[model samples]
Target chain A: MVKVENLTVRAGNFEISDVNFEIPDGKYGVLMGKTGCGKTTILEAICGLKNVVGGKIFVSEINVTALPAGARGIGFVPQDGSLFTTKTVRKHLAFGPRVHGWKREKVAGRVKDLAEDLGIAHLLDRKPHGLSGGERQRVSLGRALAVKPGVLCLDEPLSALDEDTHAEMVDLLKRLTAENDITVLHITHSRREAEQVADLQFRIEDGKVVQM
Target chain B: MIGARSDKPFLAAIGALAAMYLLLIVMMLVADAIYGFGVVPFRSDNPDQVSLVSIFSQKEVINSIKLTLYSCTISALLSIFVAVPTGYLLSRYNFPGKLLVDAILDIPIVLPPLVVGLSLLLLFNHLPTKDANFEDMLNDFKVPFLFPKGIEVTHNVLGVILAQFSVACAFSVRTMRNTFDQISPRTEQVAQTLGCSRARAFFSVVVPESWRGISTAGTLAWTRSMGEFGPILVFAGTIPNKTEVLSSTVYLEITTGSLETAVIVSLMMVTIAIVVLVAVRMWDRRNEGGLYHG
Candidate 1:
C-alpha cells in the first residue's frame, strides 16, 4: 500500500496543502491534472525527492516520512525516464540490486529476467543514448523494478511516445505491474491513459485531490 | 542582393578582428620555431652554446625538468580532488551566502599572482599569536621518519607544489562547477530512489558522466601549474637543484645571461601545452557521440 496523509509540500512559490490519498496493495493508481497544476511536485514529495512541510507518507504500511529517498523503498521513474547515461541497459537493470548487495549471480539473473520481460534483452549491451524513447522508458521501468520496491511512482511514463508506441507501453506497464503485484502511483495528463490502466483514479480539482 | 551584400561587410569585420588575434598567436609560435632552429651557435661570443643535448645534460636543468613534471602533475591531481566536491556542492544546493562563497573561491583566480604568493607566504609565516608559524609548529612535533629536522614548506620544494596548487585549483573548481551545472540532477535523484545513498548516487551517476569535464579541468590545472612563476618565486624561492621548476629555470637562465637557453625552455613549454590541449580535444571528439544529453 502507498498512502499520503495530510501531506503539505511547498516548493518555491508553488504549494500543495493537506492532501490525502491512498492506493491499495497490488493496485494501479493514476493521478491526473493539467500542466503546472502541481502533479510532478506531488509525485516528488511521495518519492522523498521533495521535502514535506507537514504530513506522513507510508509505503507498504511503514511510516517513511522521515526517511531519505533511498530508505523510502519507493521506485521513481521521472518524465524523461532518467537512466544513468554511462550505464548500459543491463547495468541499469542491475544497479539497484548491486547497491542492495545482492549476490553476483542473483544480480545477473534478475537483470536477464527483467530484460526479457521488458523485451529489451537484445539491447542490453547498449547505453541509453542508443535507445529509442519507448526502449528508454522500458529500461527505466526495469531499473525501477530491479530492487522490487514496495511502491513505484511514475511521472508521465508514456507522455513522450507516439500513439502506437504509447498503446504498446500502456499494455506493457499494466501487465508488468500486475505480474509483479506492485502498487503504483502514476501521473498523467491523458484521460485515455487513466481509463486504460488506473484501478483507482484521482484528480486535482480546485487545490484538492478528489477520487473519481 | 543589397541586404546580403551589407551583411557580408559586418561578417568580414568580425572575422577580421578574430583573425588578428589568431595571426598574432601564430606569428609568435612561428617566430619561436624559427629562432629555436635557425641559429647555428645560439650566442656569438660563446663558441660552445647550449644545444638541446647540452641543455638535458646539465644536472640542474634535468632536476628542474623532473621537478616541474612531477610537481605540476601532483598539483593538478590535488586540484581535482578538492574541486569535485566543492564544485558539486556549489552546483547542487542553494545555501545562504552562496554568492559570497563563490566570490571568495574566485579570489585566487582574480587576485594578482604576486598577491596570491604573498598571501600564502603570510599564511604559513604569520599567525596572530606569533609564538611560531604553522611550519615551525609542525617542525616542533616532527616525526623521525617524516620531518627529521623540521617540516619546511616556505623556501622548500613542497612550497613549490603548494604555490602551484593554490592557483591551479581555482581554475579546476570553476571548470567543474560549470560541468556539473550543464548536467541535469534528474539521474541522480532517480539513483537515490533506487536505494543508493546520496554519496553512492554521486559516485555512480554524476562522476561517470563527468569524465570529459574532469579531464579538461585536470589538464587546465596542470597547464596552469606549469606556467605558475610569481608564487614559486615569492614563496618557494628558486634553489638551483632543489626548488627550480621549468618556469623558474627559464628565469634563472635569463638572469645568468643565457638568453638562448631561456628561449629554448619557453619553446619547450609552448610545445608541451599545445600537445596536451590537442590530445584532449581529439579524445573529446572521438568520444563525442557516446555522451547522453543528461
Candidate 2:
C-alpha cells in the first residue's frame, strides 16, 4: 500500500503542486496525465528521487517521505524498461536479490522462478539489447518483483510498444501481480491502457489528481 | 562564336588530391614496412647488437610494455572512479563554481602536450620537502608517502601516474558527463523505489544504462595516457627500465643512436595500438548487440 498526501515538488523552472493519491495493498491504481503534466515527477517525489517541497509518503504503513528512494520499498518500472544493459536477463533478476543480500542459491532460484513465470526463461543468457520490447518489459518487471517491494510503480510501461504486444504485456503484468499479491501504481497517458490494468483511476491535470 | 564547358579540371583536381592522399598513406605504409623491423634483418651477425629477436625478447622492453599496460589500466580505472561521479554530479546538479570546473576540465583537452608538461612541472615544484606551508599541512595528515614531511610524489612513477591521471580524467569526465546527461533520471528513481540502495541503483541501473559511452570514454582516456610523452618525460624523467614507458623509451633510444632498437620499439607500440583498436570494435559490438532494451 502506498499513500502520498499534499505532494509538492520543485525542480528547475518547474514545480508539481498539491498532489494527493493512494493505492491500496494488492490493488491496481493508475495515474493518467498528458505529457509534461508532472506525472513522472510525482513518482520521483514519492520515491525520494525528487525532493518534495511538501508531502508525506507512507508505504505499507511507514512514513518514508524523508527517506531516500532506495529505502521506500516501492518497486518501480520505467516506461523505457530501463533494465541494466550490461547484465544478462538472469543476472538482472539476480541483481535485486544481491542488493538485498540474499544467498547465492536463493537468488539463483528466484531468478529461475521469475524467468519461468515471465516466459523469459529461454532468454536468461541474453542481455537487454537482444530482447524485444515486450521481453524487455517482462525482464524489467521481473527484476522489480524479485526485490519484493511493498508496491510496484510502473511509469508508462507499455507506451512505446505496438498494440498486440502491449495487450499481451498488460495481461502478463496482471497475472504476475495477482500471483504475487503486489499493489501497483502505473502511470500512463493512454486511457485504454489504464482501463486494461487499473482497479482505481486518478487523472492528473496541471499537477493535481482529480479522482474518476 | 561558340562556347564550351567542362567539369574536367575540377574532377581532375579532386582525382589528383585523392591520388596524392592515397600515395601519402602508402608512403607511410612503406616506411613502416621498411624500417618496421630493424636494419639487422631477421638474422644478423652482430652479437654485440641486439637483433629483432633480442630487442623484442629483452626483459626491459617487455617490462616497459607491461608497465605501460599496467599504468594505462590503473590510470583509466582510477580516472573512471573519479570521473564518473564527478561528471554525473556536474551534469545533473548545478551549483556555484560549476562553470569553473567545466573550464578547468576543458583545458587538458585543448592544451598542447608541451604546455601541459610545463604546467605539471610548476605544480610539482616547491615540494613539501623544504616548503614550510606544505610541511605544516603534511604534519597534520598521516599519509606514509611523505617523509617526516611531504617527500616524493614528483620525480617518480607516481608523478607520471598523477599527471596522466589528471589529464586523461578530465577528457573522460567530459565525455562521461555527456553520457549521464543522456540518461533519464527517472530510471534511477524507479530503481530506488524498487528497493535498491543509492549505491546499488547507481551500480545496477545507471551505470549499465550508460555503459557504452563510459567504455568509449575509458578507451579514449587510456589511449591518451598510453601515448602521453611530454608530461611523463618532464615530470618523471626518462629513467631507463623504471619510469621508461613506451613513448619516452622510444624517444630515449632514438636520441642515443640506437636506431634499430628504436624501430623495434615503435613497431611494438603500433602492435599495442592495433590491439586496442580490435578491443574497441569488440566493445562496440557488445554494446550494440546486447540490451536491457528498456
Best by DockQ: 1
Model 1 C-alpha lDDT versus the unseen true structure: 0.89
Q: iRMS for model 2?
A: 3.6
Q: Quality of candidate 2's docking, in CAPRI categories?
A: acceptable
| Candidate 2 lDDT over residue span B113-207, tens digit each | 77787777776654555455755656745333344445565667777787788789888998899999988776676666666776777887888
**Candidate 1, B-chain TM:** 0.87
True contacts kept of each: 0.65, 0.64
Q: What DockQ class does candidate 1 belong to?
A: medium
Model 2: runs farther than 4 Å from truth? A103-109, A178-181, B1-26, B35-40, B46-74, B130-150, B178-187, B206-218, B239-243, B253-261, B279-294
> DockQ for all models, in order?
0.54, 0.37
Computed on alpha carbons, the lDDT of every model, listed in order, comes to 0.89, 0.81
lDDT string, candidate 1, B1-294, tens digits:
655656778899999999999999999988877877675243344547667777767899889989999999999999999999999999999999999999999999998988888988876643223345566655644322333234577888889999999999999999999999988999999998888788998999999988889999999999999999999999998999999999999999999988778888888899889998999889987776665422
Residue A5, candidate 1: Cα error in Å is 1.1
Candidate 1 ranges beyond 4 A from true positions: B1-13, B40-47, B127-149, B286-294
